[model samples]
Target chain A: MKEKEINFEEAMKQLENIANELEKGDLSLDESVNKFEEGMKLSKKCNDFLEKAEKKITMLINSDGEIKEEEFKIEEN
Target chain B: MEYNPITVTDLNKYIKEKFDGDEMLANVLVKGEISNFKRHYTGHLYFTLKDENSLIKCVMFKSYTTYLNFIPKDGMKVIILGSVNVFERDGVYQIYAKAMKQDGLGSLYEAYEKLKSKLSQEGLFDVSHKKKIPFMPKTIGVLTSNTGAVIRDIINVSTRRNPNVHIRLYPVPVQGSGAAEKIAKGIEFMNENKFADVLIIGRGGGSLEDLWPFNEEIVARAIYNSEIPIISAVGHETDFTIADFVADLRAPTPSAAAELAVANIDDVKETLRLYNNRYKIALKKRLELMRLSYEKQIARPAFKNPTQKINEQYMLIDMKVKAIQSSIQSKISEEKAKFIKQIARLDTLSPLKTLTRGYSIVTNESGKTIRKVSEIKTGENINLRLVDGEKKAKVL
Candidate 1:
């Protein structure tokens, strides 16, 4: 299966769906195994989202008609 | 007038009467900060209202002070509504306060309540309309002051829970003149750009006046129309704003909002582990059941001893073969007895057999059997055929 770029929210949703399907016990053995594999992939993708992330803060600036992004720093107050 | 000069008491009473006679002085509203506030044992309040240049003594009786929602403290800004009059005995001008409200915040609270009820009646705050916040958001949009503790607190909490979360901050004035418009615009901008999966709009704890922008109708409507679910965390936990009612979710503080937007990575990992185990167990059970059914099917008679079924079919075939053979044999025997009876009857009628019993067959020279003498003619030559031989003789 082709892997696609998915957000953490979407990946979690898919993981939930696969878990429900497996728990229902209506799937064939082959189908159940396929679902297990897909679920594992989604789980890894979601984990990677939290693991590989670097803490970042960005500000949105509206310049003319276009929006620009700039790095923001928090000052000690 | 100088010849009939009155006493000092009369003069003081006249001045007090004049001060009271003025309608403007009778009903006055002043804005200042409280100083030297005191609450007597009788429940009456005595305080001084002062600005930068001057101060004035103010008093609120127990009856009116009982209505005050907050305890008055020195250095707290307030707006007092009452009458300014002079006491004849003390010869001092003082304010007799009827009611008091927080400075610059009284009207804002009124507006907040008004909008809250109006939106509530229109079902904007109905739980049915509120969208569910996603368990894990990729991007968290923030609408708040750019250089404040609100943004920093949200970042700290969210990153601690899940470091991969992306936050896009829209720097907008949290209060003052045009802050409400800018705050609403920030929500619209983020929504139009589809920048985040969920949004957190809020500010740190502040006075009611400082948090007025969140109470504005514009900000409330913006939250109501937001496609991305919004979590409102304006001011402290005690503070409630119009945005809170209209938002999809309400958080007591900016940090709480962050916590709501992201699931803890460790907890999610545990859930994934659980699902993995469940899948394995479910598949194992299914396979076990399938194998059991296979064993049961093979245990049936048809498969357990297949030759038994085949042997039963062979016995039926043998029975049918013997029945057919017996029927054919009986039919052959009946046909043989009938043939013997017919042969015996034929022998009784045969002339050859009669000759052996002393009877003969006579024939004329023409080789015709003679059965009557008239037919043979008296002088006709004839032959007599016995069982053993034939003889020529005269028929007379």
Candidate 2:
């Protein structure tokens, strides 16, 4: 199966669809197995995305129509 | 240095003239606490303004009193702008107030209200125009003073909730002089640059006068026109500014704004975990059902004992073979009986059998049986067939 470049939200949505399809229990065993595998793969991907997300704070500077990013730090109160 | 003695009315008039002639008395600005304040039937305000040691009668006539932002009341500290002149009838000096204001934040409050209502009428504060804040904002912009706890509190709260969230601070003057313009500029700048998903425009708690910049029209418009969703947290929970009304969302404080900007990643992770658990359970159940159905199919007769079905077919074939064999045997027996009957009849009609019953048959030399001889023209050889013997003779 060609897994396209899917975002977190899309992945979650597809996972939900797969879950629903499986839950309905109207599919053949082969089809249900395929859906379960696909859904599990998506769930793993979503979890990975959440875990690997790192906080990045950057200040945007527009100089002469050019936008640049600089590291932003919170000043100690 | 008057030589002529003047009457009491003349003396009082002269004193009033002297008081009016003084420039300081003509336009006096006095700060005192009000006592015995009264609103006359004609909409005039009569009050006594006094300090610890000095007391002066003050009167703001209906003409100027109508312009006053607040009604004067006893014990309220106020500043009166009017001329001090002697009242010839009372023969005492009093302040004829042209205008009056509370000692602190009096005029500023009026200005704030004026701008608030003006902006409100223009639909800037309408809920329909307010944008919804993103459920999960990646970047949070801060438009507040750089040298204060506002930014720090926001950062602390945001980072504590979701360490992955980004904070972009556009340090602006939160108060004093041109702070309103700078704050507005900060909002626009963030919007133009697409700096952040949401913005927090505010400062920590302060007096109404100190927080006046947030009430400025420019700041309110900035918040209203902001393409980026803004959370106005200008002061404490009790403090409501124009920015609060125009903002897409209002947080009670800067810290609260940060809390609204980003959701906890742990909660999101927990949600994912929940989904995962649900899918797993559903899949398991599906597999279990399928397995049970498969078990039922496997338990079926054809699947359980495949040869038993073949055995059933064999039994049917055996019965058919026996039926065919019985019909063939019966047909053979019937044909044998018919042949016996035919042979018996043929025996009765046979000449040999007739000979056995004392009947004989004769044939010529040509071996042709002669049924009856009308005349024998010449003697011919003949043969006779009897039951047990045959003889040759001449026909006579």
Candidate 3:
């Protein structure tokens, strides 16, 4: 969801779907391999995405219908 | 000197002007029980305020009734601040109330109830209209005052839940006049830009009046109409705002809203790992099962020694061919014997047999067998055949 290109939820759901398909044990060995590879790739992508990203915060301002965003930093209390 | 008498209206006007001139009457604060309560269709409240011994007429005009937060009813004790004056037309003295409060409670609670019921009846709080909050919101648009514990709490909570989650604070007034409008506008702005998948709108705890903007109709309507799912966290727990009812989800506090809005990245990562592990285990199991079945098939004798199996089939074919050839040979032999037997029977009836029995078959020169002596020439050469040899003999 953060990247929009990679919807984390969708990727997770698809990975789960692949897991289920593999667990059903009806697919040919070749098909199972393909699904396993796909699932592994998705898992890696999600892991990297979560691990590499840092928290971002921005203060928003609207002036005359124009919205501007500025980096926000928490000040010491 | 005072012989002339004026009209009742003129006398009443004089008394009213005198009462208006008195500063004490102009600004009076009274606490009494309400009786003979009636509301005019013109939105004026008329009631009699009385102690045990005496009573005074009070009228809160529609203009001043705007300040009333509760519906005044009979027998309800109240403190009213207004001016006492004479009504010139009716020749009656009444208090013009500017504001009224319930004896022990502020009227804000009643107003809150009133609006809550009104909006509830309108189905603004219908569950079916609520949008589902996202499981993982990339950005959480927080609508609250920027410089407060509310914002700080939300940031702390959200970042703790998922450090990757971006927070966009659309700072808005949590209370005071026109605060509702500002909040509503913030919601609109967020929605317009598709700023966040979920919005957390709220403030820190405050008094009922301080949290009034959240209970406002405009803010409620804004929450209702927002395309993005909203989590309302107005004031502390136990404080209910109309925004809470209309929002997709309600958190008791700003921190709770943050918790509600963000998905824990670690948990999600763990889930993904589980899925990966499941895929690994399942696929490995599947491969192992296939390999075992394949190995079992391969372990069969036919598969183990393919050449021997083929040689065995060849040997079977050779045996079958040999058996067929032998059967044919015996059949030929049997037929040959039958033919020999038939030949022997025929041979016994043959003239050659008589030859073999020491008789001869004689024929003339023309190779015709002579059956009687009359046809034979005396000196004609003839051939005679015995069984084994031929003799030239004259027939006598």
Tens digits of per-residue lDDT for model 1, A24-54: 8788878988988888777776666566666
- How are the candidates ranked when ordered by TM-score, highest leading? 3, 2, 1
Quote the true-contact fraction of every model: 0.68, 0.58, 0.88
Per-residue lDDT tens digits for candidate 1, residues B195-238, read 98899999987767778898888888898899999999998888
**Residue A64 CA error for candidate 3 (Å)?**
7.8
As for model 3, its CA RMSD to the true structure in angstroms is: 12.5
Any idea what lDDT model 3 has? 0.88
Best by lDDT: 3
lDDT of each: 0.86, 0.83, 0.88
* TM-score for each model: 0.63, 0.64, 0.66
Q: Which scores greater on lDDT, model 2 or model 3?
A: 3
Q: Evaluate candidate 2 and give its CAPRI docking class based on DockQ.
A: acceptable
Top TM-score hit: 3
DockQ of each: 0.50, 0.39, 0.60
For candidate 2, give the lDDT of residue B280.
74
lDDT, model 1, position B210: 77
